[model samples]
Target chain A: MLPNRSRTSVLVFLLPPLLLYCAAVLFPILQSLFLSFFSWNGISDMEFVGLDNYVRMLTADDIFWRSFFNALLYLAICLVLQLGGALVVASLLTSLRRGRELIKTLYLLPAVISTVAIAFLFVRIYSIDPVGLLNQLLHWIGLGTFERAWLSDVNTVLAAVSAPEAGGSPGCTCSSSTPR
Target chain B: MKKLFRAAAVAAAAALALSACGGVGAASDPANVSPTGEIKPREISWLLSRPADGAVINIMKKLADDYAKDHPGFALNLITTPDRPSYIQKLETLAAANKLPELFDTDATPFAQQLAKQGKMVDAEKLLKSLDVYDDYRPGALDYQRFDDGSLYMIPFQFELEFIWYNKALLEKAGVTVPKSLDDLPAMCTALRSAGITPIAIDGQDQWPLERYVAYQPFRAAGPEFVQKLKKGEATFTDPAGQKTVKWMAELGKAKCFQDGFSAQGYSDAQNQFTSGQAAMYNIGTWELPSLATDKLNSEVRDDIDFFTLPTTDGSVTSANEFVSPSGIGMAVNSKTYDPLVSDFLKFALAKYPAEYAATGALSPTTTVQTTVPANATPLYKKALETADTLGAKQAMPWDTQLDPTTNGRLQQELVLLVQGNITPEQFTSTMDNTIKQNAPKFFK
Candidate 1:
């Protein structure tokens, strides 16, 4: 769309950044792909064992399948709850004119908190001995018998760890779907 | 339009400059000093990976202050990443970028061995020999940090072992004696529960403690050599010894020996429960010695805390004398950053570490450093040292450390399943054997 001289100028300007990006990100990703074929402990000699890592991961590794299925379950929950809940909240916000900013800020708090901080906060909230906030709430509600180690129980652990992650970016999702 | 172009050009130039300064070739210029030995201040960065409560950082800060008083040319800049997994990630990232600090604390991971192979880490053994402190280390302290080929890469900070701390008063109240063998544990737990006390407090959420429990019965049944054989695929986890070990562990779980909701319990949670006298026993490493010595614990039980090793199983080849003694985190120096001043600082730090450690009722890996037990030292600390003396070189390597990383992860997960009674001992061992077999070729020849 530009004149020949302008196009040349634009290309010159873009070349430096393009080369820099390739050096920083793309090259390392490509290198990792190459390294994946070899059996290397980083300290020892790299032995070429083409496709063995993949073969093992796909076949004999039961944990890999467990983790894969676990991840899919998390994704499904996030899609249904996080994105869907954000849409509902965004609709409610759009109907409100008064205290809009305050409610929005409160809704966005979890989304804005650092991942490390959220992890630590959730860890404390799930602690069993001192009784975490969740367990304490259950006790207050006269449902104390239902309170068990949320993070440790095989039935609850996957859901416990996933809950925070699902709640983390709700505000971002809400804003993205909000009508201008 | 012209102003926008100028700003863009400036931004690109700045980015390029930053990138240039980041690579391996860009070592910061050394500070110049005057003839009168008036030195320009230069900060030697140290990346520490340790728990803040361990008082290691406090002691290091004190040492740095003392060093500064003399040199007046140096300042120490410490950056701590306290969590182990994140700390290892940061170290690996820095090493990959060739931007490691002048000094850094690290575990004896495969990455550290790789760094040694690449000649990027200082030869700690050679440095110790030069300082005439080569003979100072306790027997076998340095051996644990060596690579498969016997090359030393890390300087051991503290010698550690896993042990059980029991409340003597609680045991007495329950009319249960200290358990001398694995068989005695179930009865002890039942007696404690009958006396209205929680039995064993374990950190099941972290899962490593559970893994240790699984490893112990096997360690007793088959001896330490079995682990090496298992790693090589020569021996399977489904071997009778290993299966029996898993079955016993599952039985303990079914018996409710551990505290209620233990599967969700954390290390600190378990510790607090035991120290507060809510539980009869706590299992932890020697690193927790300082915490045990602290007055923060329940006064009623603090004075009554004592420890004992897990007793051997029936038909066990190894005795209770053999224990899980792994080397704690070690400090490594950047080979590229080595200078006379750095070497002097290290010599001073290593010399003072043992003495400072003793004040907190903890012992450094060095045997040569003389210490008078501090007035505030707990009796449990004395018991820890006595236990350490009996361990010697026959230390059981942790399953996580000995097995390949991928296999180790699955092993921990399966261990949790076993403890949860979600999987049979046979199922757990079969899964472990399959995973170990697949990865053994990578780790073993």
Candidate 2:
């Protein structure tokens, strides 16, 4: 073991990091926990509801559960599209060494693009009109019969947005009415 | 010598931090109140959500600039965000950080009501009265701002209404007559589809349009009980009108009158479909007119575009068909702000809002001057206006207006399930009922 001087110095060196952790992460989380007790709107004095908000969220708020489960579903989809694809890609790149730099740049291109642009592009592609690129691709691939509104139809919205076929980020947000 | 230099450096750093905070505190200090109760040269901020070319923002800027030039004692600094989706999040962030601007845009969404209940917004009735031109505003526009006890909360902006827009050229070519009642919709939709044209291109991708069916249509078709019941808690959303609305929604989905992937298309996408001449009729609000009127739109499509008042159920009591909301977005002053000059700016803004709105190609909630009625405006806008007198006279809580965030979220998802054909209207209503049961018991009582 080091002398007592070494132990004291180590403790002193760790102090700043510990304080930063408590101030940033720990405090906010704890504050949220306490705030959840109240029925108060964010402004006025918070009234203590004693776990009522939690109870209501689970038992009565179907929207809350829908949002919750939908998020989980999305998370699962993301894992498959992102993690699974990345692994396959990394392995392929490792095994096939030629032209790897060009391929890597192409693959990463979409991930670097702005989200709003991606959303706008996909919107055009998924439009029901036959002129949409996705419909054109469907026609070219002999899947024209399956060409339908990729975004607007409630039936295909979730899965249509799943892979997005672009990059790691998925496009399956709640329908526009749900609000950001 | 090195240790002494290090100690001196640490002391200087500590002192600099203190001075920086002290400087900010001093700068933030309120200017002395003027003897005449006028504002003492100070910057008051207004946060709003309006797109870059939006007519309302242009009017607001002009009025603010004009006021600043004349008043000299006050300056109104306006901050705006382009989209509504991010408006609330940004506002909440500002509020939490104590960076709340003096005047900010707000809406009648339950979230806005939450902010008003928290006392963040100024009493708008009081503000209007202070201007001495309160009577100049079209009556009934302020109804949405009122709380459960009838205290006003938000001041509405768009003060707009929704209606149906059809392509006259397409209708004339197809030989399908304009539908005058809800019953006529079936034949209209069926005939249009049979002729190889999509009937009504709805933006079901966004759930708000679904409100056109669930909340607005029932009242339009059957009567106003749809809104009254929700307001009084005497009627549950599970009623026949509500169910009828949902059934119609499902039937429309099954009929394939909407585009193939409608659930994904947003407002703009649906608009584009009609504008491109790919669709027969588009369902939207008055706010869409500015974009629709642009020269970039398909010439044939633009000329053929015409509006129609929402038709009633042909013979139902209270089937009067204008759907108006004072709950969209409006500029709200912070309660903490107090200045006579700020009042002067507001006076100028409200007084010119009607005229400025017309200049910007916007319709106003205030009836007299809000609209000169676009010379080319479809007859529907004026027809819809004849029914505007009934606004706020008898109503119920709009679908998402009264619910807490959690419940509203459930409707957003489950409502999509209904549209997808995975669920029924009954299921959707039950899910919503369950949401209220689980979340808002007090309101139910």
Candidate 3:
């Protein structure tokens, strides 16, 4: 129902941003998809390999499958912690009368902190030689026998790396889910 | 509406087609220099991958400043990326776009070989020869920078010998003598562990440190030829040399040689473990001599620090003197930037570098230049430099710089699993062989 002049103005305003988006995002994705059909070392001349790269990735590359499964596990963990935990936290926050602001601020702290700093913090927490916080806590609680290098153990490394990512920003979800 | 949709689809298709046709422009022809051309002073850049505080960078900075004082309007810009992995990514990306700086650090890997093949790098041999300093370099140092076909394209600056630094007090307390042969290592580890000492500290987080262990046994068992052939898919991991290496790695794991959770430990963490008297032994190169052979270390452990050369194997083809003695990463000059000014600056720098580098109680890559032991340096430091003179003909080339990137990465991962007892030696061999078979042809050809 808008006048033709207004519609033209809106289109004109949107055109620059749309072009920029295509150049920055869409172009790279399409380029990668196109380049995937060739064998290239970046510097050398690329050889056309058709679907060889895909075939190799799907069948011959064991690391690919390992990474694929690890990604799935990461997704599941994030869903449980972010979605399910956020619902529970949101409910608890709604009932709070005092210090609600402080709780929310504290929960949002990790989201504001740089990822490098957070990674360093988690590394210290998982360190084994000098005894990290996790191991120290286990020892103090009379569970010293269970104390192991969390980050180095294959059984626990996935969970160890995943915990920070999934649990770090549950506050964002919690805040969104909570009613004003 | 249908017309608009059709237009959009066609535009998208056209964009994709245009992008597919787009290619990186070829590098310009190399700069030509007249014999008597004026050496104009200008800014030059070096993309580096060394520690900012390390002896190499310190000496280079001083030299650059001294040169700048004489050449008005001259500036030497050093772009340093201390972290290895990040530096490699940056280097490769720049190289792909043919935007490499005046000079850049590189390993003599297949990738560097490709660069040389494309005439992107200046011929270092010719440059050095023209400057009359070619004969001054140590043969081993120069050899380390040569391609598989013995083509020299990069210049070496630092020479180092890797050694197993041990704590004398810890060895005496554990009642274990220094291992005389490669096979004696596992037993020595067990004896140290029995006496409540962590046997060896390793920086497994970086993976290359553990990869060094994988190279040692093969070097001792079959000499350097094994890796040279193995990297090209001419030899399999099932070969005797490879079998020895894999089994030795497994044995080291079984004996509990490295500290618990060593795979997660970083460079600084492992160094701290040894320096604090928690670990009995550490394997590192002479580049660490400043901390290891000086009072800079913890006073309690400083006096106890001593080192031994790599041990020999029974009936070993390689000599005891032949081990992991590397000249560090080499610097390649961009052919496109090889002007008269760059040539003049290099001639001045290369002449002054050796004497200045040696004065810091570190080994230099030139045979003609001798290190002047620093006043504060311990006797151990002098002893290490003297040992470098009697080094053998063969050296254990680090596998990290030898194999293609894909195979090398898989090997590093598989090595961790092998040493962790997660995978048997047989499984390790099979997996590695398959990886080399698949990836080696792409690089080697």
Which lDDT values do the candidates have, in the order given? 0.75, 0.63, 0.88
Tell me the deviation in Å of residue B235 in model 1: 3.2
Residue by residue across A69-162, what tens digits does model 2's lDDT show? 7778777776887666666666666665577666666666676677778777877887766468988888899998988766655556666666
Which has the greatest lDDT?
Answer: 3
Q: Where does the lowest 10-residue lDDT sum fall in candidate 2 chain B?
A: B23-32
lDDT of 2 by residue, B15-113 (tens): 544432321111121222121364565678878887766777777777777876866755667788866557767986676544677788765555555
Best by TM-score: 3
Per-residue error for A83 in candidate 3, Å, reads 2.0
For candidate 3, list the clashing residue pairs, or say none.
none
The per-model DockQ list reads: 0.25, 0.26, 0.57
lDDT of 3 by residue, A1-180 (tens): 556668668778877887788779876787788889999887777889999999999998899999999999999988899899889999999999988888888877888888888888888898887789999999999999989888888889998898888887788999888877
Off by over 4 Å in 1: A1-25, A92-105, A124-146, A175-180, B1-47, B52-55, B58-79, B93-130, B146-152, B172-175, B190-196, B260-264, B315-321, B332-349, B386-393
- Candidate 1 lDDT tens digits, A1-180: 565668559878886896688668765665677668877654455568999889978986666898899999988887877888888989998898788878888888788789999988987787666678998998999999988778778888888888888888778898777665
Considering every candidate listed, which one attains the maximal DockQ?
Answer: 3
